[model samples]
Structures are given as C-alpha cells and as structure tokens.
Target: MSTSSNSIARMWRTVLPRRGSVARASDRFQAGLLIFVALLALAALPVSAAIGSETYVRQQGESAQQVSERSQVAATLLADGPDITVNSRAGVVGNSRLTDAAWLLPDGTRRVGKVVAGQGRLKGETLTVWVDRTGSPVDPPLRGAGVVIDAVVLGLGLWLGALALLALGYRLAVFSLDRFRFAQWQHEWFHQLDRKTRS
Candidate 1:
C-alpha cells in the first residue's frame, strides 16, 4: 500500500478498536482525545489550504498590477552612494544604501530620488531604477517565484505548527492515561494483599 494509505489505516486502527472491546474510563478518554485531534487536524487542512491559496491569489494579482503600472528606467547617480553591505546569514544576499539619483519620466520630466545601487558606484554612473505610474522611483514589485514561495511557506508553517500542537496534546493525554492506569493497578494490588492477609 502507499504511504498515505498506510498512514490512514494506522490512524483508523488507533481511533477504532475490535468489536465489544472493553476499556476503562481513562482508556476511553484517551481514545476520544486521539480522535478529536485527528478530526481537528483534518478540519484545519482545508482552512489552511484556503488561506494559502487566497494569499497567493491576492499577491499574484497585486504583483501583476504593479508590473503593469511600473517601469524600469535608467537613472544617473547624482552623488557617490554608501558602499553596499554584503551579509549572508542564511543563504540570502541583500544590498544596502540608496544613492541620490535622477531619471527622465516617460513624459520627458525629470524625477529625483534615492535609488539602490551597487558598491563603489560613482557619480555620473547610470543604474536601472523602477518607477511607478507617478514617475517616482519605487521598489520593484514581487513576482513569479516570490509569490509562490511566500504562499507555500505560510501554508506549511501553519500546518506544521498545528500538527506540533496536536502531537504535544496527544503526548500529554497519553501521559495522563498512563498515570491513571498505574494508580488503578496499585490500588487493586493493595486491595488484593489486604484480602489475602485477612483470610
């Protein structure tokens, strides 16, 4: 059987028992808790998926709109910008500092702003800068991989977090049941010993 089928079978075995099987109060409660957790997780799956999909759709739509409303233009550096800082903490690279720059708008108007540039870029150097409908230099819009990545990350993170909470709850339930069972066993043992002594 496939792994998913195997998992489903195992879960059913846990939540279901043989016909006419007897159980103590603690055992029944534990079983009920297990079933509750399973059902809760299953119920949350759709909610999480919907949230992820909604976020992706919204982001993709916004990204497309931004792309349509924005354009990249070459801007001339007006001043020497601060050196770009390259720091890699977890496989992510980022550039820091924006240089004073000016670019011509599509309507033949000049726009001035601080635009991102590489390290050691000197005055009179030209760099590509994104501009919005207003012809103001603006940050680039997110697209493609970024939108999908964010959606996946959010979905997985929420799902995994919920699973972790459920696992912890199940462990606590089992611990409580085990303790109750042990106490019951001890009580029966003591009762049997007392009866034997009296006899």
Candidate 2:
C-alpha cells in the first residue's frame, strides 16, 4: 500500500506543473485582493473614526460625565428640585456626560437619576437629560448588517473581474492547444486530400 501510495504521489508530481507557478498566481491574487480591500477600508475608516471621536468628547462619554458629576454636586448642594438650576454654559447633552453620578437623597442611601442639565438660550430654557443610565448600552456587539452590503459590493467586483480575467487567461493558456489541434486536423485533412488528388 505504501509503495503504491509513493508511486502515485511520484506520478502526480511528474504530471503536475511547477510549484513556483502556483505560488506566483497566489501572490498575484493576494496583491489584487489587497487593492480591493484598501479601497473600501479607506472610505469607511475616516467617516467611522470621525463619528466615534466626536461622540467621545461631544456626545457619549463626556455628556454623561458632566451631568453625573453635576448631579452629584447638585444633590449635595441644594437639597430639592424647586431651586436646582443647571446653567447654559454647561454645554452638550445625551451620552457624552460623565459616567459616575448619583443623587444623595435627604435620607442617606444614594438614589440614581439621569444627568439633569438645562440648555440656556437667548430665547428660552430647555432642559435635557444627557445620560440615561437606566437603559442598556446603545452600542451593539456583533454586526451582520452593513457587512452584507460591503460583501455584495466587493463580491460583485471580484466575480466580474474574475470572469474577465479567466476569459483573457484562458485565451492566453489555450493558444498552444488551439494551434496544436488545428495543426493535427490540417495534417490529416491534407493527407486525405493529397491521396484523393493522386488517385
């Protein structure tokens, strides 16, 4: 069995093309794939990065922090809601507020409320809650959504390119085959024609 396996393996190697050719093809495909990926990555990267960076300072992380800190301070400062006033200059709302903020109720134990901030405008006053610690996190864990879109776009490009390349490469690879077949047919046909002419 081992002898047969060895013989078959040797035969396979003898019949197969050079290993270097396969490696070269793999390298070419890798280079092409990198180009395809870089285009998408370049477009998505900046937009997504800008959004996250802005959100950290302006929206998600900071808003919560400020509100929480102030709320803690407010609870300690005034005692009740009738006179509790957060001012205009405090700036942004929503998730950007500080994380750790809880109210000290009159009794003793800590009570939790949203970071309470009122936006001040020249016209009027608008109060906003920057952080709702009550709710679950807004960020999702695993994503299967835009990936499908990207895959479809990238896949279509790859498939179409592959088809065109195959068509071209097939013409390249089989030029010799076409010529060999044509030569064989021409030789046989001419031999018959010559015989007929002589007779």
Candidate 3:
C-alpha cells in the first residue's frame, strides 16, 4: 500500500476503540484528540473568512469616504529637495522627502506648505500631492488594495494564533498522558515483582 494509505490505516487503528487492540486507552484518547483538533481547525476556516469579509466591507466603505474627502493636486516645489546621498545615508529608502511647495486651492488661492517630494528634485519641479479641502497636505487615501491586504492579514493572523493554541493544548495533553502511562508501567512492574517474590 501507499505510504499515505498506510498512515491513514495506522491512524484509524489508533483512534478506533476495538476489542483485542494492543493500543492503550491513553493512546486511543490522544489519537481521538488529534482528529478532533484537525476537524476544529477545518471548521475555523469559514469563521476566519467571515471575519475577513466583514472587515473588508467596513474598511472598503471607509476608504471610499476618504477618497471622496481628499483630492490630488499638482504642487510646485519652492526649494531643492534633499540630496539623494543624504536621504540614503539617513536610512530613507523611498523617493519621498519633505520639502516646501505651493499648490492652488479649490478657491483659486495659492497655499504654501511642506509637501513630500522626490529626492533630487529641483525648485519649480511639479509633483502630485494629496490634500484636503483646505489645501492642506495630507496622507494619501487608503486604496482598495490596502483594504484587502488588511483583511487578509487579520484573517490569517487569527487562524495562525488559533492553531498555535491548539498545538499547545495538544502538547500539554500528550505530556500528561505520558506521565500517566509511566506511572501505570511502574505500578505494573512492582506488582509483577511482588508476585514473583511471593511465589
């Protein structure tokens, strides 16, 4: 038989309580507990997915609201951006650098503010900036991709945490069972020795 089939057969023999089975009661209990934990893990899949779906829906709505409240505008840099070497030496990995810039508000008024620009950009260069209705620079709106990623991370993290707990419980159960089996063996050994000495 195949290795997988042999393993399945062995598991079944260990879990099934049958007459004349050489397996001890503790062994059968451990096997049964393992099967139960596997089934519980499978059952948690749908629950985790549901939680993820709910989180995605709620965050997607929030993202949509943010997009509506935010607008992107072209900002003219007023000063030279940080040098590329300085940015790299400062452990800044991305192209972003804080620099003074100016952009037009919705009311046609010009607003000067510190905006994030690419490193090595010279004065008068234009870059896209996200701003609120007051023409104040703000972080970019959350994207759909970010919402999905958050949901996936939360769902997977919860599932993994649950698996860790289940594994811990299994380990504890096995430890207790091992202790019980050892004690039983010691008692049987002494009983056999006593009977031999009496006879």
Candidate 4:
C-alpha cells in the first residue's frame, strides 16, 4: 500500500477502539489529541485570513491618505553628490547620498534642501523627489503591492506560529504520557514478582 494509505490505516486503528485490539487507553488518548491539534490548525486558517484581510484594508486606507498628502516634483541638484566608493571586498558601494537641491513648490516658490540623490551625480542633474504639503522631503507613498505583501506575511507568520505552539504542546504531552506508561510497566513487573515470591 501507499505510504499515505498506510498512515491513514494506522491512525484509524489507534483512534477507534476494537473489541480484541491491543491498543491501550493512552494510545487512544494520544490519537484523540493528534486529531484535536489537526482540527485547531484548520480552525486557525480562517482566523488568520480574517486578520490579514483587516490588515490589508487598513493599510490600503493609510496608503491612500499618504498618496493624497504627498506630491512628486522634479528637483535639480545644486552640488555634486558624494562619489561612489569601491571596496576591495564589497565591490561598488554607496549608491545614494545627501546632496543640496532645489525644487518649485505648489505655490511657485523655490525650496532649497538636502535630498537623497544618486551617488556620483553632478550638479544641474534633475531627479524626481517626493514632498509633503510644506515642501519638506518625504518617503514615497506606500503602494498596493506592499500592502498585500505585508498582509500575507503577517497571516502566514501567525499560522506558522500557531502550528509551532501546537506541535510543542503535543510533544510535551507525549513525553509525559510515555513517562507514565513506563512507570506503570515498572510497577506491574515488580508487583508480579512480589506475588510470585509470596506464593
């Protein structure tokens, strides 16, 4: 038989009590616990999905707000950016640097500030920059792809963490059960020895 079919048959034998089967009470309990863990893992799926959906919605709202508040403008570099450095072991380094630049605000007023520019860029080179209402440089607005990725990562992480906890609990329970079964066997062996000596 296939491995999966063999596993299923073994599970059935352990989970279901038979009239003349050698399965012990502990064995049945362990099987029940295993089934319960599997059920809990299945139940966690919908819960994680719900949480991820909520996260996606909330993040999309925030991203929309950011897009509304931010503006992109062309800025001209006023000075040379830091030169790109090469390392013997790291190859090319310093891909970005803070450089003086100027851009026109919404009101047609010019604003001068230090903005992050590509390394080795010379003066007068133009680059797109994101700014807020006050013309202060800011990070670009969050994208839809980022929101989806965040939600998926959070959901997957939560599900995996739940599975880890369940597996740990099952292992601890099995360890305790094995210890109890060993002690019971030891006690039975000594009791039979005592009875034989007394008789």
Best by TM-score: 4
What is the Cα-based lDDT of residue 1 in candidate 1? 88
The C-alpha stretches of model 3 lying farther than 4 A from their native spots are 86-95, 190-199
Candidate 3 on 1-199: residue-level lDDT in tens?
9998997788889998578889988998988998898898888888888899899999999999989999999999999997765454677554667899999987799999999877789999999999997889999999999999999998888888888888899999999999999999999999999999999
lDDT of 4 by residue, 1-199 (tens): 9998997688788999678888889988998898899999999989998999999999999999999999999999999988888999999886887899999998999999999998889999999999999999999999999999999999988999999999999999999999999999999999999999999
lDDT of every predicted structure (CA atoms)? 0.84, 0.44, 0.90, 0.94
The numbered model that scores best in lDDT is 4
Instruction: Give the poorly placed runs of model 4, Cα more than 4 Å off.
Output: 190-199
Is candidate 1 or 2 superior in lDDT?
1
| Candidates 1 and 3, the one with greater lDDT | 3
Question: On a 0 to 100 scale, what is the lDDT of residue 178 in model 4?
Answer: 98
- Of the two candidates 1 and 4, the one with more favorable TM-score, higher being better, is 4
Per-residue error for 23 in candidate 1, Å, reads 4.2
Give the per-residue lDDT digits (tens) of candidate 1, residues 8-121: 665565456567756565666776788899889988788888888999999999999999999999999999866656577654345547779999988899988888877778
Model 2 Cα displacement at 85 (Å)? Answer: 51
Which whole-number lDDT from 0 to 100 does residue 52 have in model 1? 89
Q: Any residue pairs clashing in model 1, and if so which?
A: none
| Candidate 2: residue 99 lDDT (0-100) | 32
Weakest 10 consecutive residues, lDDT, candidate 1?
87-96
TM-score versus the correct structure, for each prediction = 0.76, 0.24, 0.83, 0.86
